[model samples]
Target: MDNNYLIIRIDEQQNIELHYFWPSSMKIKYNYPTCITIHFDNLSSCFSLVSLCYCFNILSTSHKLYIGVEVFKAYLSVKFSQSYIQE
Candidate 1:
């Protein structure tokens, strides 16, 4: 496990949002809340965050968290039909 990595909360909808990334290079660690958009200071940091999350989720232990789809829907609570932009 990387000490310098971001945790992206996986929710339902089979959607993998580019939630955050890990930047071990920083003096202080960064944290992003679920459902909130993250703005990183560097370009590489952003890429590193996504790459790690994708790989980790794929290779990590076979837990119910990853296997359960209903859990994600309950956690994220995002409707597919809903748009981010306001009318």
Candidate 2:
């Protein structure tokens, strides 16, 4: 997937769901229940660091962390609701 975003789903117990895109060369294991690691499509050190920090900031914001996710989900729900792709 060429998605440049992360998807997080949270439940009643605060258990979180996360899905992210990873590059091919990296290996990762989901050892932590609350976190998931993504192997980026590129190994650009500067890019990766900046992106990680940026996402962390976005996810830590008071409302962006939750509201943004809900909004993205709703958008996807509506977008993929009816899909009859013509070949």
Give the best candidate by TM-score: 2
Winning model by lDDT: 2
| lDDT at position 53, candidate 2 | 55
- Predictions in order: lDDT: 0.35, 0.38
**Model 2 per-residue lDDT tens digits across residues 1-87:** 221344554334323334443434435463222234323222234234434654344443543445344534533433455322111
Candidate 1 lDDT, 13-59, residue by residue in tens: 43434333434464544444223222322334434553455434543
Error of 2 at 48 (Å): 24
Estimated TM-score for each candidate: 0.23, 0.24
Off by over 4 Å in 2: 1-60, 82-87
Angstrom error of the Cα, residue 3, model 1: value is 1.9
Judged by whole-model lDDT over C-alpha atoms, candidate 2 comes out at 0.38
Looking at candidate 1, what is the lDDT of residue 63? 34
| Clashes in predicted model 2 | 3
